[model samples]
Structure formats: structure tokens, C-alpha cells
Target: MPTIHLRRRLVELDAQILEQKRVLLDLQQTRIAVERELRETATYPILTLPVEVTIEIFHRLPLEVGDKMGIRRNTAPISLTAVCRIWRGIALSTPTLWSTMNISFDDIPSTVIAKPGLVESFINQWLGRSGECPLSLTFSLPQLEINSLYDQVDFSIRRLRPIIRQYAHRVRYIELDFKEDTRISELELHSSPFPLLQVANVCCDFHIETRVFSNAPLLHSLHLGGEEGVIVTRFHLPWQQLTTFEGFIDNLDLFIVAPNLIDVKCYWSGRESTLGVITHSRITSFTIIRDCDILQYLTFPSLQHLDVYPLVTYDFFESFLKRSCPPLISLGADAAGQGFAQWHKALVHVAATLENIKISYVPHEVMTSLLSLEERPWLSPPWRTLNLLPNLKTLHLSPVYGPVDQFYELVRFLYARSDKLRSFQLEWFTTPFLDAWIGAGAPGAHEKADTITGHFSRLQTAGMDIYVGTPNRNYAAKTHDAADV
Candidate 1:
């Protein structure tokens, strides 16, 4: 072997090494381009968005916590973090997305991070991300056997007190739905006051002697859902500060005490034959359902909306009207006590201001009287003299079976008020037609029924929010023409 031959071999090897390095560089550049393209196109469209855009998108998700429906574990913000590193960063950074929570203690250890011992830490972490935003919290307990509920609810409350106290000042809305008939020994709240609490809904048959929610200065709305046994006075607070009161009220003291109260949704059905009268100047809306007889003792000067469902006494109802002399905007009542004629007479007091009328159930007498009313809902003196409700906006009727044939009369009645009308709901409008449609041996019955339904549809379009069907059906799409319905 010669020295010159060895030199030639070394040069060839060096050339081969240079070519391999060039190929390696080409492969590295190709890999970089492929990775970039894959991130842009192959990744989820949502994930590929700008971080801010992704955060905004995540905020729109309906994140309901402590749901037995599995929405939390599947679609919660936590789940977003589990998707990938990019989403995890995005979700963790968004504070408003974790500010609101609707928690139920029904399915224990299946909500949030979903373990027996982790819920507390999970909740702390969930809310910790909310930053300085106000919190909206709802804590509910499922119905269970008394023995079983005691230990479970006790444990939950023990765990919850500290968390609630931590965010008490930040609470804007808080609803505590405890198990039925839980004798709660009110804990000594040696913690911060709820200065930002605007709404507090406490639904429990409490046996506590101490007053709750007394420290909340900004509370405006309070819903106390206690049964007959739970005395209303037990959980007393600044009643005068509340503008809206719903659910239970044992006596008429609410009207007497709550001077600032504007909206009163009373579920009182006390059958006391007599009670003293009380006046509330600020009550604008009053809706009561199920056998109510409390109207006799109350009067409102500035009443705008009144909804009552009862076989009301004519004397009391008329007395209520004469005493209040309110500028009523809406009225929901049944033709009871002295029947339709008397009901109409009572309505004369506020007919000038009444725009919305809801009749509970129409019989032959009620239907006939309703048909007789001259086209208007107000007192238009030059327009034919007898105007019971001249400027009518909405008319809701739940007709009985016998008055099914009176649909045409209803049509005529609504046709006059169509100018100012917004809504006209006729529930069970197909009840009478069902017999005919189901073959009462009548020829062309089904076609006739179809035509009737079609007519109702056409009539619905005439009004801004007209619907003729059962309670659960959507007969018409509501147009915000007149007022909120």
C-alpha cells in the first residue's frame, strides 16, 4: 500500500460524511415545517384560536357544577384543562368562567373532581381562580331519609361553612336549599359579613331560634320557602330593606312592615274568616297561586300587576278594588264569588289602567260576559261609551270544555284589541275538538279540526305573542311587542 492511496481513501470518506450531514439538515427542516402545519390544521379549531379568543369561547360554556346529569365531569372547565396543555392554560387563566356555581349535595362524591375527600379542595381551587369577581352560589340538598340525611348534610355543612365564609363578602347571590325539616342550630358567625349579598334564597323548614342573613346590608331580594310549620319570624332580618319577597308569609305583617317591598309573591292560603286591613304603597306586582283568601286584608296604591288564583269572594274582591284604587296594568283572576258579572263590576275600578287580563277558567257565564264587553279595555268616552277594557294588550284564557264553541267569539273579542295587543294565550284550545277529531261519527271531522287549528295559527300571528294550546306547547313565537309576558 502507498501513502498516496491512503490519502485518496480519507478524502472519499470525508465527502461521504459531508453528504450525510446535508441529508440530516434537510430531514430536520422538513420535520419543523410538518409540525407547524399539523398544529395549524390537525389541531382542534377551537384550540388553534388565539389564546384570548379561546378564553372567550370557554366562558360561553354552560358550566353547572354538582350536577348528577354528568355535565360537570364531561363539559366543566376542569375537563377543558384535561384536553391538552394549551386549553389547560387557557381555562386556568379565565376567572369569570368559575365565578358562578350551582351545587347540589344529592350525588355526593360525583361532582367536580369527584372523590369523597377531594370535593373541598376541588371547590377551593375552582373558586380561587375567580379573582376579584362577585360569586353566585347555590347549594341544594337532595331529599333523603331523615337518618341518612343527618350525617351527610352535617358533614357537608361542616365542609361548606369555611368556604362560604371565605367568599361571604363577595357573594352577590346565595341560595341554600337544606333538607326538609332540618333543625339547624345556628352557628355563631364569627366571620366577615356579606356586604355584596343582593339576593338570598333560603329554602328550609328550619327550627333555628337565631336570625340568619341579618348581617347582609345590601340584600334586596329574599325568598323564604318554609312550610306551615316553620314560623316566618324565626329567620327574621331587615324586612324593610327587601324590595322583592316570595314564597311563604304567615300573616299580613309583610305588607305592614315591608314599606320598600314592591314585588310580593304570596303563597298564603289561610282561611281565617276575618283580619284587619293593611295598605302597601309600593307593591307593583302580586302573584298568588292555589286557594288564596288573603286579598281581603290587603290594599296596594301603586299596584301594577295582580295575579290571583282562587274562588275569590265578590265582597272581598270588590272591597280590595275600592280600597286600593290601584293603577293596575295586569290582572289574572277567576270568575268566582258572584260569578262573571260581579267580577266584571269589580274590574271596573282599574279597567282604565288594566292592559293585560288572564282568566283562570271560563264557563258559559264567564264566556258570555267576556263576549259582551265592548271592544276596549279602557275608558274611551267618545268610542261607544261602554269600554270595560279599551286598551287591552294581553288576554290569557284557560277555557273549560263546554265553552269550546266560543272560539269564534274569542276571535272577535281579540280582533278589536289587536292594535294594542301583545299576547293572547288560550290553554287547552284543542280539548273540545279532540272528541270530534277522534271520530264522534261525524263526517269531515278531522279536516274541520285541522282547519280550526290552522285558524288559531293565523290568529296567533295577528297578535305579537299569541298562542293557543296546552301549557307545555309552543303555539307561537313571542315577539317583544307590548310588554314582558
Candidate 2:
């Protein structure tokens, strides 16, 4: 029995030895893992790349993203540490990456100046990183906040004075979104600091004081939006390189001269002021939206396209065509409810070089005016007539209260007279008229239907197209009676 007990004890000893061997293997594996991690952490590359490559990669990122990544103009140091230790060190060492600052104060509450010092520190870090490179600052202030700040908004404005003065020569673009009165008063005062600014887009409710633009020699494009009472007293825009100008002025009388202006869009919502003084012959395109009657005296000698939505008398049309006598290539006008006599009076002096014409609201009385021109003996031959546009390729008519026959007659006249007629589009047809036209012929009566089909087919053969469709009926009744069906 004693010999049997000794054998059992030896088996237990073997199990203990195996357990210790397993623990030693685990310790050796853990030591190797720790050593490898230590080596990798020590060898990580931080800012080892050339500065040029870093700058190029930085430029590929958007300004907003860069700003969020800790790159800011003059004041805020970019925080690259959040990404990885290596990246953080590289971003901190590079100053040029942090030169451009985009200050968006739209959501910042004006009442809370609690973090002004922190905000100022961030701005300074970005400037310090930027070094001497020109700073691009974009300030977007929402209308609600601007209104809330009112006279008190200038306190926040004063915070930017130091940065503005330091980078006055380095600032390239200054976009101020006033949208309210708080920033309006400061615009004039801040103009003198941005000497290197080239482009400005101001959306304010106040007229820019004339003295504000007196020193802007490099300003090329200006977009001004304000109330109708804001008058532009500054006549001489100093930007010799200016090409595009757009704004809604209170009065056309304030604008007398623009020497190098090429494109001008003016929206006059008030009473039409005299535009005789605007004689910019270099203007190629002009859009006027107003309820004025003084269009005749204004001249656009080099104008190619003219779009006017006048709520005044149709006489403005005849007067402008007589005075300017431009070879207009495209013309769009709405003379709805007016007789054909008025249309003829307005278009009689129009140039024959017109290639496209769109006239809406052709009343029944104007039917005779179109037919009377066909009977004139002194008028040139149908195709060669001065009043009929030979180069006209497309004609669109939107009749208000006229018969289908009037449209048919006009189409026939244009097809017979104009050699370059290409397409005719008829829109907003009444449902009753469309039903009658579509239901004219009896079932299986193809010959009688041919009359309607022939009109469309002929248009196709002559390289002309016609469309007959009704406007969308969104609010109409869905259920229909047997009679309607």
C-alpha cells in the first residue's frame, strides 16, 4: 500500500512542472510585444516631410476644414495633436499652414463676451502661424444677430481692429454680410483699413456711404443690396479693373457715369427715375425690372440682349426702340391684354436682326394688326419685310383671351413670311379648348382628324415644332361626372 501511494505522488509532481512551463511561455510572449511597441513609438515620423509638400497638401483642404483643424489667420494655432502625436507636432511647427483665418461670428451671441479673451487668443495664434502671407478673412453675420446687437455690435467690431490694421496690406478679400443695421455704421469706418482688398460683397440694409469706396482702387466686383431709399452719391468708382456691377439703387438719377463697366443689372422697385444720364455704350447685357416709363431716352448702342419687365405703359417699348436702335438678338416682353395695334406700335421700329422673339398676352384686337402688315404695299416682300424678322428662328405666344384660330393664323403667317422659322410653342391651353380639339373627330375617322394631324406634321417637315398642352391643375376636383367623362 505504501509503494502505491508513492507512484500517485510522482504523477502529481509531473502536473505541477507542466503548469510552471506554461506560465514562463506567456511571460516571454508579453515581453516581446512590449519591446516592439516601444520601438515603433520611438521611430514614428513627425514633420519629416519637406515644407513644400506639407503646404501643398494643406492647400488641398478647404478653408473651413482647415480652420476647424486649428489653422487660422494670425491668431489661432492649429491643433494637429488630436489626430495623432506625429501630426500634432508637424502642425504646431508649421506657421504658414495657420495664416488664413475665417472668423464666422454668425452664431456667437453678441450679449455674451465671456470668451472674448479666448477668442482673441485663437485669432492671434492663427496670425502668428500665417507669418507675412496675405490673410483672407470672411465675416458672415446673420441678420437676426446683427439686429439684436444694433448699436452694441460695434463693440465686437472693435475686437477685429487690431487684426485688420496689422494685415491691411496683406488682406486680399473682405466679405462683410451686414444683413442688418448693426454693421452698417461700421462699414464706412472700416473701409480705409482694407487697402489690398480686391472683391467685396455687401448685403446690408443701408446704403454704402460714398466716401467708403473713394479709396478702393483695386475693387473689381461690388454687389450692394439695400432698401429703396439708399442713394449712391459716389459717381466715380475708382476700381480701374472693375468689370461686373450689380445692385438695387433707390434712384437711377444718382448713377450718371461708369466708364469701364461692362455688365450692369439694376432692379428699381420705386418710381422710375430718369435714366438719360446712363450712357454707358460698352454695356453688352442689361436687365431692368421696374414700373417706370422713361425707357426711351436711355441708349445702349452696343447692347446685344435686353430683358425688361415693365409694369408701366407699353409706350416705353416704342420709345426705347426708337432711341437706342440696337441690333438686338433676343427680346422678351409681356404685352398681355393689349390690342394688336399697340404691339405694332411698339415693334414697328425694332431691328430686323432679331433672332428670337417671345410675346405674351396677345389680345383679340391685335389679330388685325398682324394681318394688316401682310397687306401693306410699301412693306418689303413677305420674307424680306422690315417688320417681319427674317432671321427669327423661334416664336412663343401666350394668348390670354384669344381664339385658337388667332394662334393658327399667326403660325400660318409666320411660316409663310419668315424664312428662318424653326419652332412654335403654345402653352397654358385651357382644358375646354384642348378637349374640343382632341375630341373633334368621330371614332375611326382618320381623314377628318388628318386636318389637325397635318398641321403638326407640316411643322415637323419644315423644321418647325409645335407643342399643345395645358397648365398643371393642382387644385381641381378629382371626381368627375359621366358628362365630363
Cα displacement (Å) at residue 162, model 2: 4.2
**TM-scores, each model vs. reference:** 0.75, 0.58
lDDT of 1 at 131: 91
Backbone clashes in candidate 1 total: 7
Global lDDT for candidate 1?
A: 0.67
lDDT of 1 by residue, 1-485 (tens): 89999999999999999999999999999999999888866866766668778777787766545344222332377768887887787777878777877766665543333455566676777789989899988777646765653444333555677788888989999887776655333333334488999998887665566466668889999887766533456656778899998887666667766799999787784755344777788889998755456777888889999887764566767778789999998888875434344576677788788888888766666666566555343643323322656667887777643545655555545545556777877766453442112101112222222233444444455545666656677444433232211
**Residue 392 lDDT, candidate 2, scale 0-100:** 68
Model 2 stretches with alpha carbons more than 4 Å out: 1-106, 109-114, 117-138, 145-155, 160-174, 183-198, 205-210, 213-215, 234-241, 253-255, 269-278, 294-297, 334-341, 358-387, 394-426, 429-485
Cα lDDT, model 1, residue 351? 77
How much RMSD separates candidate 1 from the native structure?
A: 8.1
Per residue, candidate 2 scores C-alpha lDDT tens digits across 1-485 of 79999999999999899988899989999999988776556554324567567556655554333333222233323434465665666667765666556565644444433455656665676577666776666665555543464533333655665655566676666666555565545544335555676766656655445445456567777666555544655433454456666777666543354556666667765655554435567767666665434454467777677666543566666667677777778776655423223555555555477776666665545444554564464765432243555676776655544554443344345445434667665544565232112222112333232233344444455455555444454111222221100
RMSD of each: 8.1, 9.9
Q: CA lDDT of each candidate?
A: 0.67, 0.55
